[model samples]
Target: MIGQTFNQNRPLSQSLDTQGLKTKTRSFWVPLSIFFVITALSITVLGPQTQSIFDTREHIVQLQQDNRVLVDKKNKLTSIDKSLLTRQARIAVSAIPVESSGLAALATVRNKAFSSNITINQLRVSEGESSEKDAAKEVRLQFEISGSLSDLLKFIDSLSKAAPLLRIASVKMVGDGVTISTDLEMKTFWAELPVSLPPLNTPLNQVNKKDQDLLGQMNNLKAESLGFVAPASASARENPFAPY
Candidate 1:
């Protein structure tokens, strides 16, 4: 009886020990395995994506900076364009006019000669050959005048300062001690009306130093007015039946 009891107790104790060992394994190894699985998922799934997100943010910042720079450049270009247009308008006003004709130019020369006390013997005016590509038309004038040397010099100087901007092409002079006979060939310009303007995107050309100097010279020149016509009051018929 004593031996059987001891055998039975021994079997029961072994079974209890085996159950405790199983409980310890469930508590330790199961949690450890789960932790390892979660760590592997993080490394495999989220690690590469973290760097990609940061790179995308940096790229977006760079694009924003480039956009700001382009906007600033656009504003500056707009300001420059406005300034150029204003200057161009002023230059057009001071430039040789398009409305002038050979008759008008001849009249101007006659007026200048009369004012200078020079006698004009012969006056000829003609239009020069012009092409479609030219911006201005050329007008030629040949004239003969007689005056003392001092008076001739003064007349020539006045011509240089005259408006409708004459260019002296040639001068032939024959003197007979008492009076000098001068033949002059002069050229002047008249602008053609613009048919169309160039495209807006065309690049603006900067004025050169020489052209700027010429503009300054023109600005300093005195303005010349076309001779005034008498008002209607002066020409009105004092008698209603004068002429039609």
Candidate 2:
């Protein structure tokens, strides 16, 4: 009965209608399409430039990993460092011992003269602590030499070249030939400089010996002159040239 009533009330074409319908468009939809188009264009235009920047950054990092500063640049960097730490450490270690080595130095000096066939007379050794202005204690010597000019010259060269260090203060000479007589006053430095020096003509030899023996003599004579009774303390302070 319901099916008959529906068929009667409505036309059969309307009940099964497939007709087109009118539609309304909103303003937001148009703007939204334009926004998506602008977004796509920006990504397309900016993509390569952004990727190029990233690639450049990666190149720099890879180069840094593969490369090192040149030797000249490294030296310059070392020079720019303000500490001078290695130099100061060397000075402190090798330098501090020169103070008490005057006696051994006198022995070595006289030996140099003797080896050169020169005669040393009126040898004298003296030592003094540094004044407030000097910042370094100094040990000094004065003596006379009678020898050929060549021997005298050689002696000077030898002292300047001596290990454990020596410095000349003044020189006086008379006679030009083989019979010349010269007077010299010289200075040396040590961390624990000698107070009073031993007499000259000691048997210390600098030319040949065990390194330890040479150092031992130097150290012993230094201690004797400076009146330092302690050895353990000194041993603890690093040797300046120790395997550097």
Candidate number with greatest lDDT? 1
TM-score of each: 0.56, 0.40
Q: What does candidate 1's lDDT look like per residue over 1-244, in tens digits?
A: 9999998899899999999999878878978898898888779877778878899889889777766766665665666767765675465444566665565566568777888889999988888876766657889999999998888888887777665667799999999977999999998777756768654444345566887787666555344455777766654668777777
Cα RMSD for candidate 2?
A: 20.3
Backbone clash total for model 2 is 5
Q: State the lDDT of candidate 2 residue by residue for 1-244, as single tens digits.
A: 9999988868766645533221233546779899988888768867877888899999988666444434444455456535654443444445345437676566668667766888888888788667775356677888998888888898888766553456788898999666889999988676644467443322222223574454443443211122234555445548856875
Q: Go through the candidates in order and give each one's C-alpha lDDT.
A: 0.75, 0.64
What lDDT would candidate 1 get against the real structure?
Answer: 0.75
Cα displacement (angstroms), candidate 2, residue 168, comes to 1.1
C-alpha lDDT (0 to 100) for residue 171 of candidate 1: 93
- Models, CA RMSD each: 13.6, 20.3
